[model samples]
Target: MKYVEKAPHVDPVRMRHITDEALLAELGVTSIAEARPWRRPDPAWDGPATIEEADALIGAEVDFLDKGRGRSRLYGFHYLRWMTPLVHAYRETGDARYAAEWDRLFRQWYGTRDQVEGDWPGLDVIWYSLGVWARSMHVTRAMAELADEPALSDECWAMMMKTVLGGARWSAEEHDEFRHGNWQFVCAAELLHVATLFPELPEAPRWAEIGRARVLEHLELDVRADGGHHERSPGYHGMVLDAVHRVLALDPSFAEHPRVRAMHSWFASLVTSGGWIPHLQDSGVVWPAGALRRGAELGVRPEPGSHLLDASGYAIFRAGHLHTVINYGPYVGHELEPHSHHAALDFVLSGWGVPLAWEAGGPPSYDDPGYYDWYQATRGHNTILVPGEEYTEDRKAGLDLFHAGQHVDVFAGHHHGYSARHDRRIVFVRDEPSYWLVTDSIDADAVWQVHGLAPWKPHGSGYVTKNLLVVPLEAPDEVLHGNGPARIPDPATGTAEYGEIHSLGLRRADGRFTVALVPFTDDPPAVHLATVPPLASPQETSVPDHLRVAIGGIVDTVSASTWARADVREGWAADG
Candidate 1:
C-alpha cells in the first residue's frame, strides 16, 4: 500500500465492486475477454486502492454503452489517458498494487479492445489512426515510466514495443492519410515522444525529423493567424496547445516561434477576470487552470490586454474589473466552423464579481436535449433572429468600424447572415456607472433575446444578476418577457442552472430593441429610456441610442444614427 490519493470517496454503487472476482460475477463474464467493451475504460477513473477494487467498478458501468461505443475512437483515446496516472502513482510510491493494476488493465484493454463489431470500414473505428496512434504513445510512455521496475510482464513489454515501433514507422513513412487539427498535432506529439523518450530505437532520428516537419507545417495551417485554434473552440484550442507543449517538453527551442507565442498570448487574453473563457463555440465557462499554468511554465508569456483578433472576429474588451467578449462569425471555413455558435454578434460579460450577461449553453456532450435547438440555434443567442429565414451561417462577417477611446470604446460589426444584412454595435463606457450599450440593426422583422446569469430577478425595470442589469431601453419597467431559466455555461460541470434567461422578444412591428448592460456593486442605478432624435438607420425604429442613463447624479446619452454616424455620446453631465 504505497500509493493512495486523498479523494477516496467514490459512488456507493462503484464502491461495491471491490474485487475482480466480484466484477466477473456482477457482469456475468467469467473472463475479462467476455467483458470486452462492457468493461470499457473511464478516463475519469480515480486510481483504485487496489486493482481488485477497480475491476468490479469498471464492470458496474457501461452495460448499455458497449454496443453504442463500438467504433468510438474518442472512447479509446480516453481509456489510454486514464492509464498514465496509474503509472505515475506506481512511480511515486513504488506500490506493487498500483503497478499490478496498471499492468492488468493494460493487458485487459489490449487483449479485448478492437475486436471487430459489425463494421464495414477501412479500420476498426475503435482503434483507427487516432486510437492506434494514442495507444502507441501511451505504450511508449508507460515503458518509460516503468523503466525502474518489472511493472510490465515480458510478454506485455514485447507487445507494446511492437506497437511503438509500428506507430513510429507509420509516422515516418508516407502512408499519407490526411490528418489536421488536434489529430495531426497529436501524431506530431507522439512522434516526438517516440523520438526523444526512446532515442535508442533505430528509427528514432527519422521520427524526430518527421515530427518536427509536421509540427511546423500544421502549426501554421491549423492555428489561426490571430492565435486561436482554427476550429473556434477554446477546448480544442487547449488541445492543440497541449500538443505544442508536448513538443516543447522534448525540444525547448520551439517556444521561440511567433505562432506559439501568439497562441499563448491569445489564450491568456481570452481568459476572463474569473479565469473562465467567454468562448463562442463548443466551450464552457470552466477555468483552464492547468493549461494556462502550463502555457506560463513553457516560458511563452501572454501579452496581457484587450485584443481585437480581427482575423477570427473575436473582440475582447476589458475595463477595470469588467471583461466582455463579442463574437462575430468568420471563425473558420464553413466545415471547420461547425462547432461555432450561430450567434454572431453575441457577447458575454463578467463584472461586479459575477457573470452579468452570458451566452446560450454549450460544450454539450451531445446528451443535452437543447443542444441543437437552443444552444447552437440562432435564436439561442443574443443576436436578432429574422422572421422568415435562418441566418446564412456561411456568409462572411467583418468588423466594419472600431474605436477604443479614453472613456468609451465602440466595436461595430456586420454580417450578411440575413438577406438584408445584420449589423451590431457595442459601446462600452469605461467610466462610472459602467455599462455596455448593444444595438442590433436589421432591415426586416427581427426577434432578439437576452440572458443574465442565474438566480436573477426582476428589479425596478431590468433583470439583475446580483446587482448588474440587462434591461431593454424600449420599456424601462419591463424586463422583456420576464425572466426564465435557460442553459448557461457551468464552470464546474459545463452545463448548469446558473443562467437566468430573461428572453425579451421585440419584433420589428413592435420596434427593434436596444439593451443596456449595466454592471454595478452595492446598489444598482435606475436605468431609463430617454427621448432623442431618431437616426436614419435600420434600428431607427428602436431607440437604443436614446437611453438617458442616470447614475451617480449624472446623465449619459445612448442613441444611434442610420445614414450618418450618430453622435453616440459617452459623457456624463451633472444631474442639475
Candidate 2:
C-alpha cells in the first residue's frame, strides 16, 4: 500500500487545459449546445449512412424506454444512447422540443434514484457509470444550456458530483489492503477524473491525492512486470487495463510511468484468434465489448508481427511481449463486492483470436436450481477437482495460491469434502509457441481413492476420457480402456528418467471412494489424484450417469480397479 505522495511534478491545470482544448477542437464545438450533436449519434447501420439513419437509431432507443420494459433501475447508462441523440438534435437544429426531451429524461433518471438507495456497488460499475455521466456533464456544459431553469442544472450537477465523488470516497474507505489491489487502481481512476474536472470543489484535491497514492500502490503490487492482472480472467484483465488507461489519459504524468506503458502493452497481448480471449472462469458471462471499443478509441493497436490474440496468455507489441494471464492474488476485495462470482483456479486459453478452450460460463437465470451447481463445480471450469465434492454447496471457494510469468499457475482453494484427507493442484505452463497444463493432487493419507469425473455427458455415449496418465490408453471394452505398463512419475521431480510409480488404491470418503493416479513420466512428478465412487445404479438415474475412466490415453471402461502409468514426459501431465 506504499505510494509516492509528493505533489506531482506536472501541473494539473495545464493537463486539463490541453485535454479540453484538444477535445473541443477535435469535435468542432464552441458552446455546450454545439457540443450536444457530437456527443450522441445513431449507430452506423451501414458504412457512413445519412444523419437520418442516425436519427432513426436514436428514435429506436428512445422508443425502448417508452415501452416501460427496459432495465428497471436508474442505472445511469440505460439513458445514454437515447440522451446522446436528444442532445445532438437540440444543439444542431436549435429545436426547443429536442432540448426539453433531453432535459426531461435526464432529470427523470437523475431525480428518481435507486429505490433501495445507497452508493453504487462494484468498482467497475461505478467507473462505467461515471464515464457516462461525465460525457453528459461535458456536453451540457455544467448545465449552462439549461439557463432558463438553473435549478434543474444545479440539481443535476449536485446529484452527479455527489454520486461520482461519493463513489470514490467509498472505494477509498472499503478497500482491503491485502486483496482487491486492482480495484485500488480502478476506483482511483474514476475519483481522479472527478477531481480533474471539478477542481473548485474543496475536497477535490484530497480525493485526488488519495487516488494518486492508490494508483502508485497498485502499480507496485498488483501489476506484474509482464502486465498481467493478478486474477486470471481475460475479461477482468481487459477491464483493469481499460481502467488504467482512463487514469493515464486524465493525467499525462501517469502515462510516463513504467506501469502505465507496461499495462498498455500487456492488454494488447490477450487478444486471441477471432478477437476472442481465452474465456477462462466466470469471464464467459460477458464478451469483451467495452475493452475492444475503448482500445480502438485510444488508437492502441496490436503488434504487427503477432496475432491479435495469442494462445499463450501473452500479447506481442512493438515494445515487447506483455503477459495476458490473470493473477488471482488481489481477489480478496470481491468478497464484499456484488460482481464477484465463485470461480477459482479456472483459466481461459485463447490463440489466433479463437477461444481454444473455456470454462462454461454462468447461466442467465440466477434463480435456476442449478445455479450454484453450475457456478461452483469442477466441470464449470477446465481445472482439476478432487473426488467426493471439494466445493462448498454454496459454490464459494478460497484462492490458495497463484504465481505469474511466461506461464501462470494456480492452486486449489477449498476442499468440498476432502479438507482433512487430500489437497488438489492445477498448473498451466506455456513454452512460448506451445502450451501444456499439469494437474496434481496430494493426499495426507497414503491410501486413498482418486476419481476423475466430468459433469457434462460426453457426446453420443456414456463414456468419458479421464486422461490421468501420460500414455494413451487402449479401448478394451465398451465402457473401459486400459494401457501403460509404462512408468508414471511425479511432477515436482525434475528428472526426465527414472519414472516414479505409485500403486493405484481406492478408499471411500463421504459417499465416494478415492482413486490414485501415478505419474507416467520419468522422474515422475508427485501424483495428483481425485476420488470417484462407483457409478450409481441406473435406477437412481435421475442424475444421468455418464462417468467413464481410462488408463493412459484411451477410453476403456466404465469402472476399472487397475490401470498403468506411462513414461511420456513431453505432452500433457496429470496428478493423482
Top of the candidates by TM-score: 1
Q: What lDDT tens digits, residue by residue, belong to model 2 across residues 310-337?
A: 2222222211221223312212234433
**By lDDT, who's the top model here?**
1
* Residue 72 of model 2, lDDT score: 23
Question: What's the C-alpha lDDT at position 7 in model 2?
Answer: 18
Per-residue accuracy of model 1 over 348-448 as CA lDDT, tens digit each:
77874356676665634544556666777776667777766876667577776666566776777878777877777787877666788777767776776
Error of 1 at 519 (Å): 1.6
Question: Candidate 1's error at 167, in angstroms?
Answer: 3.1
Clashing pairs in 1: 454-498, 536-562, 537-562, 545-558, 545-559, 546-558
Give the lowest summed-lDDT range of ten residues in model 2: 37-46
TM-score of model 2 vs. true structure:
0.49
